[model samples]
Target: MTHIVLVIDDDEERARTAAEQVTDLDWDTDALDVTVLHVFTDNVEGATISQFGPAREARDVLEAAGVDVTLAETSGDPADKIVTYAADEDADVICLSGRKRSPAGKAVFGSVSQSVMLNSDRPVLFCPPE
Candidate 1:
């Protein structure tokens, strides 16, 4: 069965690099399809522009690497969208970059990585930023 790898990231550069890393691992493209889903939270008006650039860059990176990928841009809370997209796609594995948040930040706002780990049924790969 083909493995569908879903990469959930908010940072465009990191997301693209992560996808490239996966491809560099020599995973068979024919057997593994990598999908890069860039989650953006744009509750206020005219907020999408900030998020759109990165997503597009990430998509470009994946395409340049010759990996079969689908780029999706959705507006909402990041963690919620990531979970929903993974479940909806029935992904075989979900890949994400782990960020080190300050204690105050964590207390005020929960981590997306933590949420995905808790909610996703499929394997979740947390790639620390390099």
Candidate 2:
């Protein structure tokens, strides 16, 4: 069966990490279809997915690893959009980066990763970020 993976990418390091993690999975690369989703909070410069470094990196790395990859873009609250998109795509799993945050910082400003993890029915894989 084809397994769909939704990678919510926002930064180059995290995007590459998530893509690499997907490649490392025991599943066959041919059976895995990955979509790198980037939610735009602001696009004052009129940026597109092609112009985004994170999405480009994810696509390049995954493709080089022999995994099918695509790029998707949207504008909204990242957590909500990620969950919605995953469901829309019927994704088998979701991948994203979790920044190291202090307890107080997390409490004050909720994490998109944490919110998605709690709200998404699909399994979520969180990679590392600075």
Candidate 3:
């Protein structure tokens, strides 16, 4: 059976890195599928997935690795959308690229990663930006 890895990230270079790292770790798997998910909150600038370059790059990376890759996007609360999609898909693993934020910033802007970690019952892999 193929394992499904759901990767949630914003359009950042670090997001690509997280996807790359996850793919590298599972390079030897007999079958693997990766779904790159970009959740666009009200704060996001674009409505289309094409606007998310890094997420597309991450999808390309997985595709080049012979892994089945799917790119998807949805507009809503980032954390809520991510967790809901993961659960709905019955994803084997969920990967997130984390960013550093001050307490004040987190309070004002909210942290999607934190919310996902706290709410998701599935295994969540937090990848810190290098």
Better of 1 and 2 by lDDT: 2
TM-score of each prediction: 0.77, 0.92, 0.84
Query: How large is the C-alpha RMSD of every model relative to the true structure?
Result: 3.0, 1.5, 2.4
Q: Model 2 Cα displacement at 2 (Å)?
A: 3.8
User: Could you tell me which residue pairs clash in candidate 1?
Assistant: none
55-120 in candidate 2: lDDT tens per residue?
Answer: 888889888988888788899898999999999888888888888899999999989999999999
Model 3 agreement with the true structure over 1-130: per-residue lDDT tens digits: 4545555565568867887788768455447777788877664455576667777788777777787887788878888888899899889778888778999999998998889889998888888777
What is candidate 1's lDDT per residue for 1-130, written digit by digit as tens? Answer: 3444445555666766666566666666667666667655644545453356555665566667666766665667777787788788888878877667898897788888888888878788777766
Cα displacement (Å) at residue 93, model 2: 0.4
- lDDT against the true structure, per candidate, is 0.68, 0.82, 0.76
Highest-lDDT candidate? 2
Best by TM-score: 2
Q: For residue 1, what is the lDDT in candidate 1?
A: 36
In model 1, which runs have C-alpha deviations exceeding 4 angstroms? 1-10, 43-51
TM-score for predicted model 2 compared with the true structure: 0.92
